[model samples]
Each structure stands twice: as structure tokens, then as C-alpha cells.
Target chain A: MTGSLTLRAGLLSCILLTAFLVVWHLATRGAGVAVEMDPEYAALMGATATQGVSAMPGPLEVGATLWRHLRDPFYVNGTNDMGVGIQIAYSIARVGIGYLLAVAVAVPVGFLIGMSPLMSRALDPFIQVMKPISPLAWMPLALYTIKDSGLSAIFVIFICSLWPMLVNTAFGVASVRKEWLNVARTLEVGPLRRAFLVILPAAAPTILTGMRISIGIAWLVIVAAEMLVGGTGIGYFVWNEWNNLSITNVITAILVIGVIGMILDQMLARLARLVTFPE
Target chain B: MTTPRFISMEGIARRYPAPGGGRTTIFEDLWLPVQRGEFVCVIGHSGCGKTTVLNILAGLDSPSEGTVIVDGQAISGPSLDRAVIFQGHALLPWRSVLGNVTFAVRSRWPDKPREWVEAQARRFIALVGLAGAERKRPAELSGGMKQRVGIARALSIEPKILLMDEPFSALDALTRGTLQDEVRRICLDTGQTTFMITHDVDEAMYLADRIVLMTNGPGACIAEIVENPLPRERDRTDLHRHPHYYTLRNHLLDFLVTRSRTFRDSPPPGYDRRHPPVVRPGAAPQPVPVPETGDTLPLAQFANRRHP
Candidate 1:
């Protein structure tokens, strides 16, 4: 019965998504914006030829266009491009690179800052002053200095992701118990072992919490960053659809983007669960 | 298990830097001639520098005034040779009970294989009566269980001296009783030389072969040292039934409580003279015993734990 209920919930979710798409289809199909009649679209072609009417393609026409391109690809990621799959792969790649870089540097630096009072106090002023500025604010400088749109986007993601990790690392390190340190001393664990075995594990959950927040913020920034640069990311897809005055395409991209972001956040949440309280 | 002198701390005195700068003498010119297998408990009021004194003996801290020579060697920084079981267990929250014990062993004897270490730790987990719960973390264990882990960790090293700083004081009454009995049994069985500090007079009276009573703080000294006349195998549950138990408890109680009245009422020597009543109202400048001198009698001079 429990298994059947889970199946029912799964089906219900698909049904709800379909219903939402249908409502979206109805609302945006013939709504105010004018789509020039295209001869290539079969339904629009019939209306254009029979009634001499300039009938733009509707929701179904766009779906048919999307369906045609779904599998027929131009190898964007290893073997596939010019399709929705490749578009997703491209965005995922950017998020992965940018987020990985952010993590590699931030975690160590954060730990260092956290472990030492002098470092935390020394660097605190800079972090506080920099964290509040909009991640978008770095775009202009990144574009000019970095000399590449993709690199600029990555740099923004890096900037957005770093603050959480660094702050969290500092906090996690600072909160390790003095008694625990005493245990380390008594055991005669060297400084390196003390940090890795005792201090790191003790502070791991908090550090992961910081990473989760950092990644979520990074995911949020990618969309805005892609919108700024006219590229082949999911964010660019939204902007491109808006230009054609197709609200349905815009809404579809929004849904896809939201779903992808949720997946990314969940991945991080699972990672957080794996490195947790020690037994 | 019978052995020679395990721990010998001779002429130990500890002084702390007075808040501003100069040293405030806490203890001075002391002598201790502990045998290899004897159990000594120090009973003192708070700030008697009980913890400080224990730390010095444990090699966690150095004596600002005198030296602690242990097992024929002058004590240095923390070592496995002197195992300290601190109050509150001091178990790492990250490790299981077994892991905590094994870690202490592995660290001291780094060359020992993991399998051998595991076997050693397993033996002790069963010995402490936490056989099945070895995998559970410190947080999952009761306070008493955690302290058992602490004891197990201390014993794992097979150190010459076992130093405890009020190991059972933090526990609840029942748990405290259980641990006290377990500790007593372990010490007796192993014949490990032990030094413990506690505020509980009964705990001191019940556990120690001899109880060392410390005077009140701010340079408090040892007022008295009473040897427990009871047998080592005496039942802990019925300890208070011993006629000397009440008598000893009363002596300690009177020293801690009733004696304070005398100190409060008595004026400091030479308070009325030199300084006028206007200078310092009703309070007379009391005669604080300026510590005469703190000199450590060489630990080698002791009956045991002496080197040629």
C-alpha cells in the first residue's frame, strides 16, 4: 500500500505539471503579442494560404519545433549540440566549473581564517565589505578585465559562491571546543593531524551548511549572468524567447531552469548528509 | 600486579602569575613520598589550585615553583607515561567509545599494527563493561559511560601513574556510585598508583588509602593528610557504616566549614599597629604568610621511584 501511494504521488506530480503547461498554453497562445505568420509552420501555413490571414504559430507549433530538435543534435557537450539536452549540459558544465573552483579555494581559505583569530580579524573587514555588493556588480569589471563572456560569468559565480564558504569555515573552526584541543594535546596528535582528524570533523556539518548556501547562491547567479551575456545557457534561452514575444517559450525555459536549480540544490543537500556527525 | 614505586612527586609547589604580573604563591615547600601502588586523594576547597596542582602532576602544566619527577624521570610535557583521566571524561565527541580508547593507544605506540591496537581496545571495552556499545559515539553514551571511556583511555597506556581530577564529581548520584566502585575495583585489581582531586569528603574518604586535605585558597597549603585505616577490599555501599567514616567526615567537614569562622573572626597580625584605624576602617591588615620559600626536595631522594 505504501509503495502504491508513492506511485500515486509520482503520477500526481506529472499530472499537475501537464495541467500547468496546458493552462500556460491557453493563456499565452493568442494573448496580445503578435507572432508573424511563418509558412514553415503547417497549421499557420494552412491559415495563411486559405484565408489569406497572417496567423502566427501557436503553442503546438512551437512544441512541434522543439520536438523536432530534441534528438537531432549538433554535439554541444561530447556528442550532442543545438538541442535542449546540450543546452542543459552547457549550463551544468558552467555551474560545475565555477562552483568547483569556488569550493576548492574557499574551503581552505575559510578554514585558515577560522582556525586563527589573527586571520579572521584581519580578513573579516574585507569579507563583510565585499559580500553585500551585488554579484552583478562585478559583471562590468569581469567583462572588461577577464576579456571573455564565459569567464566573466564564471568569475561572478565564483564571487557569489566564495563568501558563504569562507564565513562558514571561519565559524566552524572558531567553535571547536578547547577541551577537544586538550584531548589532541594529550594524545600528542601533531598539528596537521589535529586539524584533519579532530578539528575538521567537528566543524564539518557547519562547513557543509555554508557550502549548501553558497551553491544555492551560485545557482541563482548563473541565470542573471547568462541573461547578461547572449550565450547558449538556459538563462540565454529565456532572454531569446522574450525577444520573439513568445511567452510560452519564456515560461517553458523558466520551468526548466527552476527544475534544474532544484536538482543542483538537492545534490548539495545530499553531499551535506554524507559528511556529517561522526560516530 | 605488585610493583615498585609507580609515581613519585616530590616537593611540588605551583605558583600562578598574580593578575597584574608577579607570582602569587599557591603552594610552597611541599613534600610527597607516594609509593608505587598507593592511592592518594587531595581534598581542597575551590581555588585551592587543585586543578593546577593536578595539571602539574599530570605534566599538562609545569610547576612554577617546583618539579614533578615521575617514575624516576623529571616530568615534562604530556606523555603516555603519566595518564590523566580528567573530570567530565574529556572524550572526543567525534569518536566511539572503542575508537577513543584505541586512539590513545595508537598515538602513544605509533608502530603497533591496527589489528593489535583493535584487540587491545576491545579487551578494555569489555573490561569497563561497555562491551556491546563500543561503536556508539560519546554523545550517545551516558555521562557515566563517557567517564568509563576516559578511565579506559587512561589505563590503555599502562602508565606508571594514573592522575584523576574529580572524575566522578560531574556525574549524578547513582552513576557516581557505580563509577566510584568500578574505579576502586580497577585500581585495586591493577594495583595502579593513583592521584585524584575532589571536593567531596566522602568520596575522598571512601576511595583513598590516604586523603590530603588542602587549606583554603589564595596560597592555600595542605592542612592535614589522613591515612584511611580501612581495608582495601571494604564494600563501598556500606562504607559509611564504618565508625571511622563518620569521624573522618566530621574532621574534614569541620576543617572546611567550622574552621572558616575562626579565620574570619581572628584579626591579621600587626593590623592595629603601623597603620592607623583611619587608614583602613574596621578591617585590620591581616598577617598573610608570605611563602617562606619553595624548594623541591629531589624526587630521587624518595623511598621508591629513585634512580642510582
Candidate 2:
């Protein structure tokens, strides 16, 4: 039942996406008339009239583009373009590193903050100050400090992803029921053991939520970082396509970036549910 | 001294800081003594520090004024020898019904095989009528079942003294009765000392060998302790049918309902309990000293009062 329900929901979303795209094209199709179906506009769209297609390639075109990107990939990737898969892998790898680092550092720090009032009060202002800064703003500073573009991107992702997780971890640990702590004390669980087996597992849901939020921010920041760093990533690919006047590739990259982000977020959501099933 | 009383709270006084700036004394000069294999219920109105007293016994909190000695030793913190059942079932949401009880047993007895721990947990689940619910988590169970799991978990260790803080106050009448019966039977079977805090008048009259009633909060003192006149083995359904049930119930209700309201410093409506009237007052006065547990009331005490 769960599988079928999810499948039905997925199909429904696709249908809704088609309807929305149709409406979007209809609103903009008349733009072709305004520009007289100019050949310049069709540089990547392949002369809309010649292909017997609308200026904006219908749902079928996007679907074909998506399928080709999934199966054959490169030959269909773009006009003078890097493969969409490579662009996606670049961003995912940076996010993976930055997210892992964030978890490694944030979790321990958060546990201490939650366990000790002095630590929480002391570190709270620093966390509050750093969490809200824009990732691109950090890119220039990181680039100057690290003197390496790739590492700077990683640093940017790390900074962007750190706080949600840290704050959530602290909150989760703080909210662990007192009775459970009493049980741990009764069993003679030491401070470290209590943090590991009792408090962490008990607060796993909240911590995972923080992780989810952090990963999302990390993914978003990597895009901004790649654009600023001017490197080979999904963000760079979109910028490169725009500069080369390949509008189809740009649109395709936009869709791919969104879909990949959705998948990553969904994976985190699934992990959260698995840990917090409450049974 | 005095066989250590199994569990003794000698002049325990807990005073938590009041809001803003003031010390709120919930309990002061409270003397609680429990013998092994006896069941005692601490009955009081809200904020009487019954739970505070229970926490001190469980070693989760300390008394500001006195010591809580358990098994002839001072208690510094929680230990396996004493188990506590709070009002809400605190079962870990991530674990299964069997897992909840098994977690306690496993932590305490790491060397025990998995099968043994699981078997013991399953037995407790069945004892709480959750045989088919071994894999179900706390969320999947009803409120009563969750509390039963709490009870089963407490009993699983076979702790020497079980501390219950209104464990059944939230349940409806039917489930409450069934679980109360189960609790009585289990205590009878194990002979573990129990100290429970509750507000139910009939419960205090029914289960406890001794019911310690406390005054109002903000200096909640142990006003009186009533010993149940009936035997522990008496049929619960027919318990109130005994001639003395109404009398005992009314006497306890006076302390909990009437005395509590009057203790708030409000003016009384022409009632004086400090000195019993020579002639019968408007309301028929209850007998002063109800007979203690495991003892018969003298004919002289009952002679002054009628069953009605």
C-alpha cells in the first residue's frame, strides 16, 4: 500500500508538472511572434520552424531531453556543453564533503552545548553570528584564505551547512525526556555512554532534521559557490551555457539541478523517518 | 537500627526555588518509613510534593533537609535496586514494546544472552496483555497499554522497592480497575515494597496498608496517615460493600477535599475539627482514630458510631 501510494503521488506530480509547463509555454509562445521567430533565438532550439516545433519545445521535447540525459547523456547534453551528469556529480561531491564535515564537527559541539549550560551560553552568540551570512559572500574570503578554488568551495559549503545541524542537535539533546536519563543513571551509564546510547538515539529525530536542513543549505550553497568560483559544476555549466547562447542546455541544467536536489532531500527525509518511527 | 525500615526517609524536606525570588517548601519534616513487602500509598492534593518525595526515594532528587536511606545505605543517585514508574509512560519511541522492557534488562545484565533477555521481555509483554504486540512501538499502543508497559518494565528488574507517582490517574475507570488488580496481584506475588502517590480516595482506602495524606502546597506537610482497616486479600469489588467503607471513604475525603480547601486560610462555615463538639454537630462527626492495618478495631471505637 505504501509503495503504490507513493507511486500514484509521483505520477500525479508529473501530470501537474506537464500542465504547468503547458501554461508557461502558452504565455511565452506569443513572444516568438513579437520577435518574428528570429533565428538568433533558435541557436540552441534548432530553428523552431525547421523542427516543426514550438519555440519552447513542448512537454515531449523536455521529456526526450530528460530521457536522453538519463540514458545516452553526453551526445544530447548540450550545445558546446559539459555533460549534465558531470555537472551534477561535481556539486553532489562538494555537498557530500561539506555536509560530512558539518556533521562531524557540529554533532560533538552540539552535544556539549546541550549537556552543559555554560557551553551553550558561551558558543551561542558565535553560532548566531555565522549562520545567516550568504554563501557567496563567504566564497571570496574562503578563496583568499584557502588560496584554492575547490577547497574554498568546500569551505563555503561547510559554513553554510553548519548551523542548522548544530542548533537542531542541541535542541534534540536538550529535549530528551528526563525519565530516560534517570533510567540511564539507574543503569550506571556514564556521561559518554549516556550521550551515545541513550541521548543520541533518543534525540536522533531532531538531529536528523537538523542534518536535513543543513544538507539542503549545503546543496544550495554549492551552486552559488560554483557560480562564484567559476569552476566545473552544475552551476558553472548553467553559466557557461548562458554565455554560449545555448538556452536549451541552460533550461535542461535548471531542471536537472532541481530534480537532483529533490532526490537528495528525499533521501534525507527517508532516513529521518526510519530513525523516528516511534516504535 | 529498627531493621533500617527497608526504605527510610528521616525528616526529609525538599524546598525548590520559587519563581522570581523565594524558597517554596513543598515538604518539611516529612518522615516516611516502609518495611519490605508492604504497600504504602501517599495521598494528597496537588502540589503536596508527593512526586518530589517519590523522586527522592528513587534517588533522582535529593532532600534539602534530610537523607533518604535505602537498604541501610544513603542514596546518592538512581540505582537498579529502586525502579520508578512516572505518571506518563516514558517508553522510548524508537524501540518496540519488547525492546522497551528489554533495554532495561539488557543494560543491567549485559552478560545475559539475547534470547534470555528477549524471553523475559516477552513474558512481561504478555503479562501486560501485549503478547501480539511484541514488535509494536509505544506510539502504536493505547494509553493503558503504554502504562502497562511502564508497569511491566518496572517489574521486569524485580526491583526491591517500586516507586509509583500516580501511575494510574490518567486511565479510565475500567482499565484503571483491571490494572490496579494486576498491580495488587503482582505485588502480592513478588512481595516488593511499594510507595505510590495518588489522589483517588478509594484507591488509598483499597490498596495501601498505610495511606499518608499531605496538606496543601507551599509548605506541604504530612497532615495524617490513615491505615486501611481491611485485609489486603479482600475482594476489591466487595471492598466498599463492607460496612466501614463509606465511613473510611468519607473520612479520607474530608482530609483531601474539605480540609484541603479549608487549609487555604479561607474562613470556615461554622465547622471546628480542632476540638470535637460534645454533642453531635450539624454534620455527623467521623471517628477520630481509624484502626490501623492488620489489626481489628476495638468494639469500643465502633460503639460510638452507627453504620449509616
Candidate 3:
């Protein structure tokens, strides 16, 4: 039943895409009415003024630009110009490093908070205050303190990724069934062994859910952080294309960003499924 | 008495602070002893703190007042020597039947090789009649099967005393009967000392060697301890056919329905916390001392009257 549902959904998506592309093609088709003008002024004015072509790039233009970028994705043209793949790679690398660093800090600290009532109460105020702050709001301080644009962007990613996972891990650990802990106690399982074998396994699904949310937030924040830092990332690429007024390139970057974000979310979702137990 | 009993609770009491100020006692000055290989089931109404007593015995929860002594040693906390089969079955849902059993086996014998631990677990699993379902997770199993896994896990550790908190109460009647039969056979065959808590009188009569009755709570105490009159080798299906079955069952029912509520307020004359009256409900009536206090009467008089 699910398989057939998925197939039908896929077909519907294709139909929607086709209809969108056809509408875009017709809407952007150049107006046949010609304006007589000075050749020199008309050359400066370009296609929109001379041929009455729509300024917004049509689906065909975006597709052609996407294919071109895909054909030579990793080429670096200088300090200012780089291929789409390199920009995507830089963004992923930053998110990966910062997110991994967040994981290292969040999970263990979350465990400590979850396990100890004193620590949980002590840290709760700080988490509550910091959780609502936007990741980009920290960019100014990060750049000031870290004194490096690239590192500042990573710091933002790390901060944005930290809260969801930390809160989730703590919640998960704190809420493990009392009966399971009683089982461990009765078995005389040592504190460390109990934490690893029983508590960790029991809390893993919830922790992974936190991680899934963190990764998505990290992906989102990295784009804005890269835009602020003016560095080599997909977010920077989009900003740069917008500055050059190349609507085709900007649309292509948006599509790439979306696809990469989806892939990252899917990977974490699969990981969450692996740890989730039925009961 | 000669060997200091295999398990003993000495004046253990559990209490929680009430909303206004003073503490509300669940049960207090509770004392009980079990000889080795004895199967004792505590029967009580919902608020009587039977589970709290079982938890105290298991060392999962410490009594607010006194200590529990097992095999000459006072229990400091939960120990490997006492294994609890929880009411909810409490199987680690992520683990398979074999894994759950193996977890306990490994805990009991940490240095044992993987093969040895798994083999020991498999033996207990089969002993609980779950041999072929080793790979099934708790979520995949029926309620009865999950509880069977719990029994297997508890038994695998070979604890000196097995503690079960209404292990079969959640199961359907048919499954409860089958599991009870299997557990009775397993406990009897292995000579495992067990302390169980349940509200089911028939279950107490069928499985327990002695059924300890507790009054309704707010300061519950053991009202009486009725010795089961059925033979040790009795079968579940034919349990009702026994001559003493109805007598034993009715006495327990009567205590729970009426006496349990009034027990704390008006305990029988000569009722002792240290030694509650031990009555064999189906036994012939015997002469007993009359009460000195006009307001109090001996509870045993009613038990004897009910049967005779």
C-alpha cells in the first residue's frame, strides 16, 4: 500500500513540475512588439528593453544554467569565483565540523544534566535564555572574538546546532522508564555500565531525534552565516549571484541548497530510525 | 527461627509527607520472615502498600524505618541476590528475548564468556517455554510472552530470592493461567524463594505456600497470614476441585472485602505486628483464647467459623 502511494505521489510531483515549467515558458516568452530605439542605447539596455524579454529567468534559462554548473561543478576561477560543487562542499564541511563539535559537547553535558538534578536545575536557566537567540545574531560577536570570517561562520553553525540536541538528550535521558532503571539496579549493574548499556540505548532514539532537528537547523544557519561572513559557501554563492544580477545562477544555488539540505535531513532521519525501538 | 530465617523484614515502614505537614504512613512496624524455598504472596487492596513492601524486600526502595535482612546480611540497596519481575514486565524493548535474558546472565556472571552467558540465558528462556522465540523483541511478543521473558530474565540470575510485583495481573485470563502454571512449576522445580504481591485471591491460593493479607492503607499492617492448604504438587485446572480450595478462597475474599478496610482502626485483640496470626482457613476449628478487650475480637475466630 505504501509503495503504491509513493509511486502516485511521485507521478503527481512530476505533473506539477511539468505544469509549472510550461506556465513559466509561456509567461517569459518575449513580446513580439518591437520598440524602435537608438542602437547604442538599446545595446546598453539589453534584451529586456530591446526585445521585451521578461527580466525574471524562465525555467529553461535556470535549467540550462543548472546543467552548465553540473558539467563543471568543481572548477575554481579565482578568489572571487568558484564552481557550485566547491561552494556546496565548503558549506557541508563547516556544518559537519561544527555539528560534530556540538554533538561532542551536547550529548555528554546533556547526560550529566539529565542524570543530576542539581546540574539540570543549574543549567536550565542558561539554556532557556540562549535557545531563543538567532544563530546570525551571534555572528557579530563571533567575528569580533574569533577574528576570522570562516571560523565565525562555523561558530554560528555550532551554536545553532547545539540547543536542540542538548535539550533533547537531556529530556530523553531524564524520562527513561523507572522500571528499566530498577531492573538495572536489581542486577547490580555498575553506574558506568548502567549508563552505557541501559540508559544510553533507551535514550538513543530521543537523542537522535534531537540530532535530526539540530542538523536541519545547522544547515539553515550555515547558509545565513556564510552570507554574513562573505566566504566560500553555497549561501555566499547565492549572495554573489544576486549581486551580479544573474537570476539564473541565483535560482540554481537555491535549488542546490534545497537538495543538499534535504539529503542532510534524510541521513539523520535514517539514523533516528535505526535507534528507535517499538514499544 | 533456628537458622535466623532465609529472609526477614524487621520493623520496616514506608511513609510519605502529607500535604499539610504530618507524614502519612503506608505501612509501619511490618515484620515478616520466609524460610528458604518458601513461596509467599502478599494479598491486599489497592492502597495497602503491598508493592512497596515487595520493593523494600527487593531493595529497590528502602523502608523509611528499618532494614531488610536476607540470608543473615542486612540489604543496603538493590543487590544481585534479589531479582525483581516488575508488574509491567519491564523488558528492555530494544532487546530480543535472548538479549534480555543474556543481559541479566552477563550481569550475574560478568567474567563468563559470551557462549557461556548465552547458553545460560537460552536455558532459562526454554525453561519459561520461550525457546523458539529467542530473536523476538518484547514489542513483537504478546503480553503473555513478554511476561514469560521477564520470568526467564529474573530466574536466569539465580537470585537467592525472586521478587515479582503482580507479574501476571496484566495478562488475559487464559494467558495468566498458563503463565501461572509455568511459573508455579518453575519455582517449585528450582526451589526458588519468591515474594510476590497480588490482589488475586485465587492466584494467592493456587501459587503461594502462605498468603500474607494486608489491610487498606494510610497505616496498613498485616491483618493475618493464611497458610495455603493445597498440596504442593497440585495442578491449576484441578485446583478448584480440592476440598480446601473454596474455604481458603472465601476467607481471603472476606478479608479483602471487609476486614481490610477496618483492620487499621480495630485490629483484633492479641494481633501482633511482629507475628500476625497464622491461620489455615480450611483446617478444623480449634479452641482459642477470648479477647480481654470488649471492643476487639480475634480474627481467627471468623476464619475457623467460616470453614467449620
| Chain A superposition TM-score per model | 0.77, 0.83, 0.96
lDDT of 3 by residue, B214-252 (tens): 999978898887888899889887889999989888899
Candidate 2 ranges with C-alpha deviation above 4 Å: A1-71, A74-81, B1-4, B260-308
lDDT of 3 by residue, A25-89 (tens): 98997886479889898889888988889999999899999999999999998967999999999
- State the weakest 10-residue window (summed lDDT) of model 2 chain B: B273-282
Under CAPRI classification, how is model 3 graded? high
Candidate 2 lDDT over B57-131, as tens digits, reads 888888898777676577888888888887987887777888889988887677899999988888877887878
Backbone clashes in model 1, listed as residue pairs:
A74-A81, A75-A79, A75-A80, A75-A81, A76-A80, A76-A81, B5-B36, B6-B36, B268-B286
Error of 3 at A15 (Å): 1.6
Alpha-carbon shift of residue A173 in model 3 (angstroms): 0.5
lDDT of 1 at B77: 85
Candidate 1 structure quality by residue, lDDT tens digits, A168-191: 888998898777777777777788
Count clashing pairs, candidate 2.
Answer: 0
How far does residue B172 in candidate 3 sit from its true spot (Å)?
0.6
Residue-level lDDT tens digits of model 2 in A157-220: 8888889999999999988888888877766666776787789998899999999988888878
CAPRI classification of candidate 2: acceptable
Top candidate, metric DockQ: 3
Q: Score the docking of each candidate (DockQ).
A: 0.42, 0.40, 0.80
* Candidate 1 fraction of reference contacts recovered: 0.53
